[model samples]
Target chain A: MRPPLIQLQGLTRTYGRGDAAVSALRGIDLTLFSGDFLAVMGASGSGKSTLMNILGCLDTPSGGHYGFESIAVETLNQTQRALLRRHRLGFVFQGFNLLARTSARENVELPLLYRGLPAARRRQAALAALDLVGLSDRAGHTPAELSGGQQQRVAIARAIVTDPAVLLADEPTGNLDTARSHAIMELLTRLNRERGLTIIMVTHEEEMAAYAGRTLHLRDGLIDRDSAEPDATSCC
Target chain B: MLLNALLLALREIRRNLLRSLLTVLGIVIGVAAVITLVTLGNGATLMVKQQISALGSNLVVMRPGQRLGPGHDEAGAPAFRREDADAIAAEIRGVASVAPVVSSTVTLVAGAANWSSSVTGTTNAYFAAGNWTLAQGRLFSDDEEQAGKAVCVIGQTVRAKLFAGEAPLGNTLRVRAFGCEVIGVLAAKGQGAMGMDQDDTVLMPLATAQRRLTNSRAVGTVMISLKDGVSASTAIADITALMRERRRLTTAQENNFSLMDTRQIAETLSGTIGTMTTLLGAVAAVSLLVGGIGIMNIMLVSVTERTREIGIRLAIGATGREVLTQFLTEAVALSACGGLAGIGLALLACLGLAAALNMPFLFNPGINGLAFGVSAGIGVIFGYMPARRAAALDPIEALRRE
Candidate 1:
C-alpha cells in the first residue's frame, strides 16, 4: 500500500538523432522503494551509467515517467530539479568530486549554504555531517591534503549533510583498493541500516554487488537479470 | 548567500594564485597608469591655476592690443601715461587704484655677475594695482615718484642673479652704468599664469625709469584695481569713456587700448591646458578600455577552467543568481584592488616628478577619486561576460565535464 520512493515506467533514452541515433535505454521499468539497496551491474556501454544519470535527475529521459516520492520529475525545471537534488538526493562517486581548495567542513557546509542557512547553523550541521562520515577530525583539511578514501568520505559527508532521501553511488569503490572499497561499503551499509536510507548503486564487481540486498544486470540498455543477493552476504 | 559565494570565489582564486594574478595584470597596469596620468594632468592644470589665483582673483589687466583690433592711426599710439592713471582714479567710481608702467630690457651688473633684466618704471599705485608684497624693504614712496628718485626695488630672480643669495636690499645694482640702490625686494612670485617669470624685474619710479634707463617719456601699460562688489563691465566702460575723452577720440572711433583682467590670460591658458589634458587623457582612457578587454579575456578563460566547479556549486544548491553574483563580485574585487594600487602608484609618481622638477605640486582629490572609481567600474564591465557564462552553464553538463 505504501508508495515507492522512486518509480520508473516505460523509460527510453536515445542519444543523437536519425542516422546517428542510438538508444541508451529501451522500454525500462523499475521501482525503488524506501530502505532498499539496489546495485546495477553492466559491462561498458551497457547503458547503466546513462540510466544512473537519468535516475539521479542529472539527465532527462527521452520517453518515460519518473516519480520521486510520487512527484513527477518531468514537471520540474532545471532549477527545481537542482533544488530537488539538493534537498532529497545524495551522491557518492568513485572519483570523489570534491571542491579543490575547500576544507572538509566548508565542503559539507556548501549544501546548507545553498539552503540559505546562517553561518553558525551551517557550521553545526556540517560538523554533524562530518561526524556521520567519521571525518570530524579532518574537517579542516582540504581535499588535496586528504587521502583518496578520506576524500570520498568527505564527499559523502557533503552529500548526506542535507539529509537527502536517496543516496546514489556510481562506481563508488572503482578507484579504491579492495580493503578501502570494503571499508566504504561497510560505512554505506551502516548508513542504510541505521538511517533506513534508500540506496541505488552501480558497479561491475560481483563482490561489491554481493554487498547489496538485490542486484540487476543491464546489457545493451535493457535489463537482463534481477535477483536477491545470496543470503550469506545479504545480512553482512 | 553572497558571503558563501565570496568565500568560494576567494578560495578558487587562491587555488590558482599565479594564474589569477597574471590574468589581472593588465587591469592593474591600466588602472594605475590611468590614475597616474589623470592625477598628473590635473596637478599640472592646478599648478597653472594656483599661479593665477596668487596674482589675486580681483586683479584686472589692461593690454592695448588684446582688446581693440590692430590698425588705424592709434595703433602705434603712445602707451597710457600718469595723466591717464589720474583720470581713471578720479573719474571711474569703481577704480580703487591705478598705476602706469614703462618697461624696457636693460643690461645690469652686480659684482662679477651680469645679466640682461627687465627694468620697470612704475608709480606707487603699482603695489596695490598688481597686489604685490615686499619680501625685504620698502616700496617707492609718493615723494620718490614725484622727485624721480633713483632707488630701485628688485625681484627675487633679479636678486638671485645680481646678489647671489646675499640680501640685495640697501645694495646698489648698476643699470647702464648708473647705480640704483635696491630699496626693496619683492617676494618670490614664481611663474605667472602665462608661464612667464614674474620674478626677473627691477622696479623704480616711472619717471626715474623713463628719464634715466630708457631716455623716453612714453608709457608702456596701465594697471587698474577695482573695489569689491563692482562689476568689471562698469569699471571697463568708465575707463573706456575716460580714456577716449583723454585721447580726444572721435565719436565713431573705438578706443585703441586694451583694458582686460588678469583672469582672461588665465582663462586662455587654462582653456589651452584643458584641451591638451583631454587629448592626453583620451589616450590614457583607451588603455582602460584595453584593460577591460583584458579582464574579459581572463574571465572567459576562468569560466572555462572552472566549468566543473561551477556545476559543483550549483549542485550544492547555489542558485544561478548566486553563481552570477560570485563571479561579478570577484571581478569587482579585482578591479577595486587594481584601482587602489593605481592610486598609490600615481601618488608616488606625482611626488617623485614634482620633487625632481621643483614645480608647484598639486594633487587634485577629485581626479584621484574619479580614477579610482573608474578602475573599479572597468572590472565590473569587463568581468561581466565571463561571470554570466559561468552562472548560465547547465548543472548536468558542468557536472558531466571530465
Candidate 2:
C-alpha cells in the first residue's frame, strides 16, 4: 500500500535535433519498490545507461513523468536535482572514479563533504563505510596502491557513505576479472540481503545479473523482456 | 565549503608545483619591479628636496644672465656690484641679509699636497645667508673683512686633501698666487643637488678677493635671505625694483637679472622624479596584466585536463557553483602567493640598491598594499572565464571525455 521508491511513466530521451536525432530511450514505464534489487541488461545503445542516468537524477527526461517518492522529479530545478543526488542517490562507476592522489578514507568522505557534514561526523561515517566494505585497514592507501577489486570496494564504500536511499551502479564490476567480479557480486548480494538496501545495476554479464532477484532486458530503446514472468524470453 | 575548496586547491598546486611556480613568475616580476622603482624614485626625490633645503630656507639667488641653462653668454651680461647687494639689504622690508659672492677655481698647495678647489669670496653674512657652519675655529671678524686680511675658511674636502690628519685651523695654504691663513674649518655637507662636491671649497672675505686675486669690483652672484614667515615673491618684487633703479634701467628696458627660488627648484626636481616613477610603475603594471593572462591560460588548460574529475565531482553531488568556486579559489591563491613573494623580492632589491646608491630606504605602505591588492584582483578578473567554462560543462559529456 506504500508508494514505490521510483516511478517512470512514458519516459523518452533524444540525443540531437531534427533529421540527425537519435532516440536513446522510448516510453520506458517501470516502477522500483523499496528494498528491491534489479539488474538491467542490454546490448550496446539499448538505453540502459540512459535509464540509469534519469533514475539517478543525473539527466532529465525529454518527455515523460518521473516521480521519486511523492515528488515530481522532472519539474525539479538543477539545484534541486543536485540536492536529490546529494541526499538520496549513491553512484558506483565502472572505472572506480576515486580522486587520483587522495587516500581511501578521504575518497569515501567526498559525498558527506558535499552534504556539508561536520568533519568529525564525516570521518566517522566514512570509516564505518570502509569497515563495511572490509577496506578499513587500507584507509590510508591511494587508488594506485590498491588492487582492482580493492579499488572497487573503496568506490562502493564511497557510494554508501551517506547511507543513500538507493545505490545506482553502472557496470560496477565490469572491469574486474572473473574471480574479482564474483567476489563483488557476492558483496552486493550480501548488502541487499543483510541491509535491505535498494540497488539497480547495469551489467552485460548474465552471471552478474543472476545475483539480482529480477532482471530487465532492453532492445532498440524498449524493454524486450522482464525476467519476473515465466516465459519472458519467448515474449522477447 | 570554502575550506574544502581551499584544501583541494592546495593539493592540486602541490601536485603541480613546477607548473604553478612558472605560472606565477610573471606576477612576481611585475610586482617586484613596481615596488622597487617607486621606492627608489621616492628616495631620490626626498634627497633632492633635502639638499635644496640645505641651501637655506626662503633663500633666492640673483644671477646676471637672461638665460638659465648651461652655456649661456654670461660674459656680455652686466655683473652685480657690491652696491646693489648693499642697496637691497638697506631698502627691502623683509630682507634678512645680503652677501655678494665671487667664486673662482684654483689650485691650493699645502706642503706636499696640492688640490684644485673652488675659492668663494664673501662677507661674514654669507655664512648666515647660506647656512654654513664651522666645524672648528671661529669665522672671520668684520675688522678682517674691512682691512682685506688674507684669512679663509677651509671646507672638509679641502681639509682632507691638504691637511690630512693635521690641524687645519691657523694653517697657511697657497691660493692661486698668494698664501691665505685658514681661520676656520667648515662642516661636511656631502654632495649638492646637482651632484657637485659641496665640501671642496674655501671661503674668504669679498674685499680680500676683489683687491688681491681678481682685481675686479663686479660680484658673480648675490645671495638673499628673507625673514621668517615672509614670502619669497614679496622679497623678489622688492629686490627687482631696487635693482632696476640702481642699474638705471628705463621702463621699456628688459631686466638683465634672473632670480631663482630654492623652493621652486625643489618643486621642479621632485616633480620630474615623480613623473619618471609613474612611467616606470605603469610599465611594471603592464607586466602584471600579462601575468594575469598567463594565469588564465594555465587555468583554462587545467580545466580541460581535469574535465573527467569535474564530472566525477558533479556525479558525486557537487553543484556547478561549488566546482566554479574551487577553480576560482585556486587561481586567487596562486596570484596572492605570487604577490607575497614579489613583496619579499622587492624589499631585498630596494635594500641593496639604497645601500649602493647611498640613499635612505623609504617604505611607502600605500603603494605596497595597492600592488598586493591589485595582484589578487587580477586573479579574480582573469580566473572568472575559465571557472565559468569548467562549471558550465555537461556532466555526462565531461564524464565521457575519459
Candidate 3:
C-alpha cells in the first residue's frame, strides 16, 4: 500500500496554561492518503476548527507526532512552518477573505506573488486559475463589485493558484444560501475529481459533508465518529 | 519584492488620496518654513555686508563725543579744526589720507527746482578717504580748492531731483545766498547700512563750505582711509593717540571723541544676524519633528484600520517582514511626496520674498537636498513602530477584526 500522505498519532492541542488550560484536541489519531477529500464536522467549540488549524500548520500541537510526507511538522520553527505553508498548503475562509478593492485576478495572484513568481507568469497563472473557476470575465472586478458566490469562487481560485499539496478550507460556504452553497460544493467536487486536488474541509452542515468522500465527527475534543470506520457508534 | 511592496503602498495611498495629503501637511509647512527663513536671512546678511563695504575699504570716521547713532548730543564736546586733519595725515604711519569735513543742511536751487540736502565740505583727499568716484566731469582742482572757489560735485539723488533730466555740469546751483558751479556728479551708492539714502548729498571745497555755508573754521568730523594691508585696530589706536595729544587731553581725562570702524560694524551686524538665522532655523527644525510625530499618528491609525488586510496577507503565505515593508513603504511615500511639495513651495516663497525685500535670491542646493533627505529620514523613523505593530498581529485575531 502507498504510504499515507499525512499521519497524526496521539495529537493533542491545549490553549493557555496551568488552571486556565483548556484542551481543544484530545489524542486525535488520523491518517489521510493523497487525493482523499475529508470533511470535519462538529458543534461550536467541539475542536473541529482546532484540528483543522493544526493540520494546516497554522497552530502547533501541544503533544503529538504530526508527519506530513516525511517532515515532522511540530518540530519546525515558525519561519519553517510559514515556508511549508507557502509552498505546500492553501486556505479558504468562510468569509471569502479576498483583499478589498483588489481585482479578482490580482486576488488569485496573491499566492504566486508570495512564491516570487515574475509578473508576466503570475498574470498568466492567475488568469488560468480564474478560468478554472469560471471567473475569466470577472477577473478585473473587485471583491465589492462581485457577487457573494463569485467572491467565494475567486477565493477558491486563489487557494489553488499555487498548486498546493492540500487545500484546507474552513467553512468554505458558511455564509452562502443553500443554492450558492451547493454550487460552491459542486465546484469543489469538480476540482477534486478533475484535478485530483486533496481537500480537507471543516463544516457543521451535513449537506456540505455529503460532498466529501469521508466524514469525521468531533465531540468535546475527541473524534466521536468516523465514516470510514463504519462500525463506530456516535458517542453522544 | 521591494518594487512590489512599493506598488502596493502607492495603490493604498491612491485609494486614500485626500487623507494622505492632509496627513503630510505638517511636514509641508515645516520644511517650507525652514528653507524660506534661512534663505531670506542669508539675503539680508549679504545686503548688510555689501552696503558696509560700499562705505569704503579700510575706512574710519571720527566724530565728537563718545556716543554713536541718533540723539548723540555732541554739543558739549570740543570739535576738531582743519589742522587736526593735517596732523593725523603727517603723524600716523598707516594713515593713507585724511579729510576734514564741515557739513550743514542747505536748500539748493537749480532751474526753479529747489531741494533740501546736506552739503559736505572737504579737500580732494575726501574723494580718496570716502571712496568716491565721479560719474561724469572731474574732481576739484588744487587751485580751485585752495582759493575757496564756488565749485561742487552733486550726488546722484541730488542730480536726479534738482537737475531732473537735464545735465547740470557747469550750471550754477544756488546754495542759500551764493551760487556754486556743478563741476561733477558722484556715482550712485544706493542705500547705506543704516537705511539712509547715501546718494542724497553734495560735496564742495573746504574753503568754499567754510566761507559760504557754515561760516566757521571748525571741522565737525574727520574721515581717514588706511593704506593696503594695514591692520585697522593698529591704525585706530595710532590715530586715537595722536588726536588725544593734539586735543591736549591729560592721562586722567577721557578723550572727547569716538571712532567708527566700518569693517567692525559689518562683522557685528553679520554675527548678530547669523545667530538669529540659526535660532529661527532651530525653531523651524522643531516643527519638522512635530511633523514627524504627525506622520507617526497617521501611520498608527492606518495600521489599525488595515488590520484585516494584514491578516489576509499573512494567511496567504506572506511573512511578517513583507507586511512590515508594505506599511513602511506607504509611510515613506507619503512623507517623500510632502517633501517634494515643500521644496517647490519654498522656492516660490523665497523668490517672492527676495524680490519684495530687494535682496538677492540665492538658490542653496545643499539646504534643499538636506531638507529632503531629512524629511525622508523622518519617514523611516516614524514608520518603524506602526510597521512593527502590523507585523506582530496574529492572523487569527486580525482576520476576526471588522
**Every candidate's lDDT:** 0.81, 0.91, 0.90
Q: Which ten-residue region of model 2 chain B has the weakest summed lDDT?
A: B67-76
> B9-59, model 3: which lDDT tens digit per residue?
888889999989998898898888888888888888888999899888798
Q: Per-residue CA lDDT of candidate 1, range B44-106, in tens?
A: 777777887787666666655434322323466556667777778888897788888888899
Best by TM-score: 2
Estimate candidate 1's alpha-carbon lDDT, on a 0 to 1 scale. Answer: 0.81
Model 3 root-mean-square deviation: 4.0
A33-84 in candidate 1: lDDT tens per residue?
Answer: 8999999999989999989988888778899898889789977777777778
Docking class of 2: medium
RMSD of each: 4.6, 3.1, 4.0
Q: Fraction of reference contacts reproduced per prediction?
A: 0.47, 0.55, 0.38
lDDT of 2 at A142: 94
Sorted on TM-score, highest at the top, how do the candidates line up? 2, 1, 3
* Best first by lDDT, ranked: 2, 3, 1
Superior by lDDT: candidate 1 or candidate 3: 3
Q: iRMSD (Å) of candidate 1?
A: 1.7
Q: List ranges where model 1 is wrong by over 4 Å.
A: A228-236, B40-50, B67-84, B133-151, B163-173, B177-191, B194-197, B211-218, B240-257, B267-281, B347-369
C-alpha lDDT of residue B46 in model 3: 89
